[model samples]
Each structure stands twice: as structure tokens, then as C-alpha cells.
Target: MEIYRDSKLILEINDKDVNLQVFNEKISMPEFNNVCKLNPRVKITDFIALKKLLNLDSTEKTKIGELKEIYELDISKDEMVAYLKIYLTNSEIDRDVDKVKTDIISFLNSKNILEGINHELLNSDIPSCKKFVVATGKAPISGENAKLVYYKLSERKVKEGTDGNMDFYDVKLIDNVEKDDWIGEKIPPTLGINGKTLFGKIVEPKPGKDAQLKYEKKSVYENPENGNYVLRAKFAGAVKFDGKKIGVDNHLVIHGDVDYSTGNVDFDGYVTIKGTVADLFSVEATKDITIEGKMGIGAVKFIKSRDGSVSISGGVNGKNTTKISAKRDVYLKYVNETSVVAGGDIHISQYSMDSYLEGKKIILSPKNGRIIGGQVKADHKIITGSIGNKFEKKTVVNVKGFERVMIKHELDSIEIILKETIGKANKLKRQLEIFESNKSRLEEKALNTFRALIINYDNIMDEIARTNIKLDHLEDMLKTRGDGEIKIVNGVYPKTVLEIKNLQRKVNDLMSCSFYVKDNELHLYD
Candidate 1:
């Protein structure tokens, strides 16, 4: 079967003695029927492997010289495998492949591999280079101290010398991607001094540049495949796009939508997002801030609050030299890892260690809260968690270890079982049992009722802690009451004093605890 340059399909045939793989790459075909052109010694298996290794599918654009300019490159098999990787993978590979490819190009340019190779390539507008060794890591290792093998790819020739002895490979390179299809095309073996070696050409910058630098601009280039604008220059200022005369730190405006979905919402003014502020419309306001909604993922800021204290309340997004401030006593109730100059005290309820905080004094209420300044300096208390971070009655509380339990869980915080509620239930049950039990040995159901009352005592304490009910005369009732209880009728019946002095005015603190300790060894059961 004869291979044509028109298609991507590879046909293999075997009639009697001869077996062949017909590759559609025209440059790889023989120059004559009688004389072997180049690397005729290379096995057909290796050619098929190289094609597969390059990851060239039948549909990945096989036509050349139309959308892409055609090229007939000459290189060695080893170097070809290394260079072809760029187009084969979606992103850049490791540094070793780049280094090897660079060496081949350098060698060709210097004309050290084969004399007139560089001249011929240059005359054809194909800039080639010769590989050379440069020292890194202070100095080269001494000859007597190092021994390594240096092998040639063109010839299976291994040369021995001091530790630093080395020679380089050569390659023919074509620049100008649109005009040169050589970038993605596989070259024949004749590019090297010895015809047995094959190398692949890539559409890229010069040798040193390809190995060291990366291509990453917003408007500099247009990817024919991706159809997106590559950055031409580094960004200098913020650009908020909502069609308003936004405060730009720089100039030259474009479409600015407040969503990280495309890029980032770059702004230098007060960002007022009418939408959910889904991106938090992160801004660097030399003044203060006010987001009607919550901050989206990865949103950061250096904002000033209405409160004198500069508070952080979102993920770090844009860099702001301006101090972060709040309106009232800035409540870090919902602050995250965003930094702030914090001219005033910083209230940190829960912040990430990755967050940087600088303030007159940081009031941390997070678990195991850490400080990174040379010295921890706080004038007031450094509450790690809530003094009673909860809500009871109508008052909110900050409680120790309150961070462990969630208070805002869907409808759970509202449905609380207070100590008074439990006591009322217990009293009703006990009265029912006394009037209802009809046996000497208490019925199992009655026993179960009593057990449930006992079981709920611990929960009662948890409710008290959760409610933070600081009843003014509660101690008096529990401690200094009359023989039974004088506050209400049939006080032993355990009815809640709903109208006690200053009740329902205390804060809430939800922490679970039960048996009151009488001594080192309490007169208590479990």
C-alpha cells in the first residue's frame, strides 16, 4: 500500500514476504526506490510508536500548508520524541524535555554537529542552533570527583573523559507559526549529520525562550484552537464592568461584569453589587465597605467598617493598602481570612491561619486562635471562642467552645427546650404517676417515665447554658427557698417561674452539663 499525504489514516500491508506501514506524513517517505534515503535501519514499529507517542489522532487536523504551513524537518529519533510533546499534551510538560529540545536546537545553530547545516537552514529561514554546556550550582564538579557516561544519539558512540566531558545534538528549527507548519509536523531523519536520526519540530519561541519562559498574557495572543485572547501585557489597575463610570486605578475600559466566571471583578472604587455579589465584587476602597449580600468564594478585601475598628470579613481577593474598618463595634461574627490595617481593635470570631491580621489588639474568638506578630499584644481579653456565642430568648451570646455547635442550623436553634419547660413536663409526669400508678411494684411504664425524667436532667442544664438565663432570684429559689418552695403554690410540683425578676433578659450559651458537684466525690448518681 502506498501512503498519500492527503489523509491521517495509516495503512499497513503484507502480501508474502514484505510488511510495511504506509504513514501519511510525506517527508518520511523514501527519496528513491533503489537507494535507502535516511534511517532505513529504523524499524517500522518505532515509526508507529512515535506517531502514537505524539498522541496524533486521526481527527486532530492532518492537513498541512493550508491552515498550517508545511515543513520538511531533519532531526534524530530521540530529540523528535522530546520536542513533539508540546502539541501532544494540553499543557507544558516537565523541564527535562524542554532542556533536551533546547540542546538539539543550540547544536544546530552553532554548526558544531555538521558543518554547513546551520548555513543551509538559515538560508532556508530555519534558524538552528548548537548545544553548549553552561555551569550552574556555583561551579562544575571536578573530574576526579565525578564519573558519568556521555552518549551520542546519531551514532551509538560513547566518549569517556573527565566528569564534565560532553558534546551536543543538532536540529533544524522553523519559527513563524502561521507561515510554518513545521511546528506540529514530524521531520525526517536527514536533518541530523547522520541520516539515521529523526527529530520533531514544534511551533514555539526561540530555543532558550521556550525552555525558560512561559506564555501567559491576556491580550497578547489569539489561540487558534481556544479562541481566547492571551494577555499582551501585565495588568496595572482594576476594571469593574457594569457600564457605570467606575473608579478605575488605571484607564482604557472594557466590558466589566462582577463575576469570577470569566475573570475577576477588578475595581478600585466602592463596589455596590446589586446582584448577590456572587463574586463579592471585591474592591480596594481607600474608604469603607458595605456588601448587601455575602462574599463569594475567594473574595478578599481591606475594608473600613462603620465601627472605628478595622475588621476583616471576607476571603483575600484584591490587595488593599487601605485599612479595613467597620460601622458599629465591628463584629467579626462572619469574618474570614482577609487582611486589614486595622487601625482599631480587630474582633476575630473565626479566621483562617492563612489570614494576616494587624490591629491595635485582635480579639480572637476562634478555636486555638493564633497570633503571628513578634509578640502577642492585646489590651482586652483574647477570647478564643464565644463568651457565649449563642442566642437565647432575644439576646445573642458568646460562649466558650460554642464554636463546636452550630446555632443557626435550620430551625434547630429556635426549637429550644429550656430548663423551665423541662421542669414543667417533669412535674406533670410525676403528678400523673402518683395519681395513676396502681401497683406496689411500680409498673415498667411508670419506671420508664421516671427514668426519662432523670435522663432529661442533663438536657435541662444544657438548655440553661444554651439560654444563658441569668435569673436574678434563681439561686434564691434553688438554695434559700422555704422548706418546700414559697415562690409559687405546690412548689414541689416543679413549675417554671416565667415571670421571675429580669428573666428572659439574659444571653444564651448552649453547652451541655448536668450533675452539680457536691464535693470531690459527689453524692450524685452517674
Candidate 2:
């Protein structure tokens, strides 16, 4: 019988006699004869030596049936699958199909690769001369995160005209939104798919994160039909979206001049005029008013909020016909031939010419602060660099006198009415007391007269009480007088009049001094 051990040749006779054992690459004739001697019943033709059958030389180390399995196995960290690699050291060696398949199966099972196993490479003929991959694994697909997509109306830009002429009407100053206008849409996150490993293990992918929309409740709301957020304009005006929050403001913006083309604007909210307010046109706002350009000739602008302010980047060059009023502070680049009023402080960056300006406090820039031919009134202080021009133009600076005069006049009127009411009440009370003492059960005419007298007395007393309250209020206002001052930084030229409270003084020369009311007299500090 013939036997193979480690791909070497072995000859056995019956069950007990062992003759030849050849492990070397080459075998001599003596070795072959010895193998025949050991197995007398076995014909040499029936059993052939491994080295002789493969025709190998003595220097070679591998035989035809003695090839060792040389292969590599790699498993991914994600447990997606395993890869099988096979190589051959000798290209002449015939590969064992069953052994290669079994070895590859054992390797994959060792690495716990139990699912998605490709059996085509295992069942097909594998080349021994080159290396090849046998198996592959699948990876999971990731999902996208949620995002917000804004509508067109929320970010509309100004359209330029192609007519070759610069038209201010082509610019869109404000982004307007109507009620139930689509503002933005929210895209929801998607769920990730599950993946399988080469080792039959499950791999779960991370899901995308979700995002919520933020907006003002009164100005925007989420639509139930499409799950999109839309703008709900509480008032017809401008719309704003700050990436996070969406809001709508009650305002009207004019892109062009307020003229016959665009009628006078009367908005309940803020008003922003990008162009000039034309002559004889009026722009009024219940809130704030912002004029980006200069006020045209004879134009009028007003703001009504005591807390809201007005800003005119371009000065009011109204030629004595432009009138501007602000309930709060007024900010201007310059004022010329205009009348301006503010409840709070007024800041003028440049000179004022022939303007009547009134506020709680008026300040002009010291660099170009010239109040020439203007009557400036402030409750507290009036600060300017030059009071009059080089030609000694007539300029008047009055401080803390308007409110005092008005309050005093009101107080006087209330006192006179109060005195008359008291006199009338005393007269009616005396008449009523005399009538009541005259009779207990008087005639109808007398009773009616007595009741009338009592009514008149009570009415007069109420009137006196109301008048006293008014008088007390006015008196308190008069007592709290501001320490008003006229601060002249550079100088006050001749013919410039300075008034502090009730006292007035004319500067006859180039005087650099601060004037204030002291002891009912205008005092000057140089």
C-alpha cells in the first residue's frame, strides 16, 4: 500500500512492514528499489514517488502533494466583513481545491464573519500564481441634518434698472410682507440605515440632528399644512429675519422723494425716507422718523413718541419753510432756515443758520459749532463754539425761560379762578344757611331755591378743589427752575443776545464766556 505523510512518500507492505520513507526533493534509484523491496506485492507502476511524479530537482523543498496553505485574512474594525487573500510560493504546485475551501471557511468562522459571505470565490478555481480577494462587506449610508430655507420675500434685494438712467424708484428700501406669507421651511432629519458586518454583526448608524424654528409669535407662525413657518403681519410694514428670529415691524419706507409721485406718508409706525422729502410734502410717524437725505424746501416731518428719537443724516436746509419736530431727541448734521423742536436734547453736528431750535438741552459740535442768526432755546443748557458769525450776525441763546413763563402764566390764571370760585362758594353757602334756618317745611318755590343754592355751593367747592390742584402743580413746576447756562466755547460776537431765565444781556464784543442766571441777573464767567 502507498501512504502520504507531510506530502512525503512512504511504502507499507500488508499492515506491519515499512520499507522506504522519502522526504527530500530528489530520490535516487536505490531509494526507489528499496521502496519496491519493502512492498514486494506493490508494483512500481502502481505507486509513484512524489518527487519523480512532479519532476522536481534536488534543490527544491516542496513536492507535488506537499504544498502548504499560505493565505491572509483581514477583518474590519466596523465588523462590516472579512477579506481573504491567498498566495502561492511555487507556481508549479497544483492547488488542492477542497483544502483551500476548508481553510478559508475556517478562517472566516474564526473571525466571527457569519453573514454576507460570498461563496462564488470558494466554489470557483483559485489561481495559485497570484493573490486575490474573496469576500466583501456593505457599509451604512448616513442621513442629512435638518436645515432652514428662507423664502424670497424675506431676503429680497433692490432691483437695478437696465434703462441706462439712475432711477431712485428702482431701489427697494423695505422688505414688505403680507399676512400668511411664506417665510421659511424647515427640513427634518432622516433616519440612518442599519449595516451588516462580514462577521454577521449588525452596525447601526447615527441619525441626523433636528432643529427648531424660532420666530416672534405675534409676527410669525408655523403652518400646519406643510409644517413650514410663515409670516403673519400684525401690521402692514417692514419684515426682518435675523437668521434665528423672524419679526415684522409696523413701518413704512419710502425709496424715492416724497412728492407728487409718492404722496405724503402718514404712517402709524416708524418712517424711513431714503430720499429727500419734497417741498410742501409732510412725513409723520407715530414712532420714530429717520430721514436719510436732506429735507427739501418747505418740507415738514414729525415724530410723536416721547421716547422715540429722530435722526436726519442730511441736515434740514428748509430755507425757513421746513419744519421738523421730535418728541424726543433730534439728531441732525446741520440746520439752516428751519424750525426744529424736541422734547429731549438736540445734537447738531454742524452750524445752524436762521433756525428756531428748542429742546431740553441743545449741543453743537465745537469744531463747527456756529449758531448764526438763530434763536436757540433750551431748558437746561445751550452749548456752542461760536454764537455769531464773523459779520456779527444776530444770534439769540435763551435758556430755562419758556417753561417758566408758561407755568407762571398758567398759575396766575388758576389763582384768579380759584379766588372767584371761593367767593362764589361763600356767597351761596350763606344764602343756603339763611333759607334753611327760615323754615323747616318751606313752599315748593322756596324749597327749589334752597336745593339750587346748595347744589351751586357744592359745585363751586369742587371747582375750587380742582383749581387748587392745578395751581399747586404749576407752582411746583415754577419752583424747580433749571440752573440754565449758555456755554460759548470759542466766542460770542457783537449783537449776539444771551438770555438766562428772565434776564437778558447783549454781547457787545468778542466775548468768550459762559452766561448763567444768578440772583435774577445774567452773570458771565470768562
lDDT string, candidate 1, 80-177, tens digits = 21111111111222324455356545644453233223323222322222221221111112222111111111221223224322111111010112
lDDT of 1 at 355: 39
In candidate 2, list every pair of residues with a backbone clash.
Answer: 80-197, 80-198, 81-198, 113-199, 114-199
**How far out, in Å, is residue 84 in model 1?**
99
TM-score of every model?
Answer: 0.19, 0.41
Q: List the RMSD of every prediction in angstroms.
A: 33.8, 26.5
Give the CA lDDT, 0 to 100, for residue 90 in model 2.
29
Candidate 1, poorest ten consecutive residues by summed lDDT: 167-176
Question: Candidate 1 regions off by >4 Å?
Answer: 1-282, 295-337, 366-381, 386-526
lDDT (CA) per prediction: 0.29, 0.65
